[model samples]
Target: MKVLVTGAAGSIGRVVTVGLAELGHVVVGLDRVPQPDGEDSAWHTVDATDADAVAAVFEEESPDAVVHLAGHPGEASLPDSLTSHVVTTGALLDAMVEHDVRRLVYASSNHAVGRTPRGGPPEAGPVGADARLRPDTFYGVAKVAAEALMSLYADRYGIDAVACRIGSFLERPETVRHLATWLSPDDCVRMVAAALTAPAPGFAVLYGISHNTRAWWDLAPGRALGYEPRDDAEDFAGIIEARPEDEAEAAHVGGPYATAQFERPALDRTS
Candidate 1:
């Protein structure tokens, strides 16, 4: 299948593109920014916010599936949180509809439901997908909007949309938080592959995390996606936890992205 990956220069995007290529799928990379200093791909640098640009890229590439990953990643203090949501993703939606793309895997975040009840380990079983979306930051708000757009497109335009609320993607599972919610890079690819080919995924928003000991969210259809994660956070427990608290404080911040301000004013985050 020909796949288009937006934000092809990003951490996951870069890996996903190469992974797709290795899987024998043709990849057309899209990004608003140019290739990073040394990174590379079949890149087409187009601002995700531009409708015509996105449309042109989609029309030219005509990929069978589009994994929308292009957007400003969350930061502690974002200058504008809504730009990526309203501009980048919104434009991509229009392009998808215009080009008659079939499957679209939107990169939603765990924070989409972060405001829900999360007390113990994440592996205790998920708090539930139906948990009301109470976004704690402007970035979360954008993800919520992106999910809504996927729904609208799926229902109204016959687009097969899946909003994957992804968990942590860490090199090692060191702290208590990652054990329950780690999303290894390989698992990430598998999840996307599964979502793309799943029998009858009818407008779904599935959690994107691996099966781990301390999980709070249940990974249901994730299995159906044929995703069996090989990497577990527990493997690194001995090493990561080997250090004491003060030494691991930064590492223990739940997820690397939990601190994301999503380019919004720091004063607006839900503390």
Candidate 2:
């Protein structure tokens, strides 16, 4: 399959682009910045927010599917957050419709339900994918809005949109909270691949995490979509430094994002 990956230069994007290619898919990269040296995929330096540019790329590449990972990766002003996540997603969905592309594997985040209290084995039942939206920050709100767009497009256009609510993506578990939330690089690839190839998944939401022993989210949804996560954060539990903040971080599904540090005025006064 020919796949287009947005934000191809990002930490996760870099991993996904290469991994998909190694799995025998034709990978095409799109990002605002120039493609990095030594990478071989067909790269396009176009911001995802630019609908015209994004459309042109779709016209040129004619990819079979898209893995959207482009957006502000952290807390930001409300307008910026919406443009970065929702607007970018809207543009891609439009282009996909125009170009007859039927599949979209979105890189949604756990922050979409950030305010939900943590629950899982040894504590309580895991949070299911159908949990209500309780976004922690403006960034999280943007994710939720984007997800709604995906759902709308899927229902109206016969598109297969799979939203993966990713956890803490890192090389290894570095903190106590990571033990329950880490999404290993290899597992990230696995999750994306599963979402991409799952037969006729009309509109689905899956927690993007490894098979962590202390996971606080349900893995059944992902497993149903053929996403068999292999890595476990428990392997590096011995190296994790337990900190006072771990308790608060583990208190919610989105960790620190649900804390006061992310609180901000809904409207940007400076603008």
Candidate maximizing lDDT: 2
- lDDT per residue for candidate 2 within 1-271, as digits (tens), equals 9999999999999999989998999999999999999997799999999999999999999999999999989999999999999999999999999999999999999999999986545555788898889899999999999999999999999999999999999999899988988999999999999999999999999999999999888999999999999999999998888899988998788899999888889787955
Return the top candidate by TM-score: 2
Clash count, predicted structure 1: 16
User: Which whole-number lDDT from 0 to 100 does residue 84 have in model 1?
Assistant: 76
lDDT of 1 by residue, 16-110 (tens): 88888888888888876787666555679888877888888987888888898877766433335567765676788788778888788888887
Score each candidate by Cα lDDT: 0.73, 0.94
Task: Pull out the clashing pairs in model 2.
Answer: none
Give me the overall lDDT of model 1.
0.73
Stretches of candidate 1 off by over 4 Å are: 36-41, 75-79, 120-125, 242-271
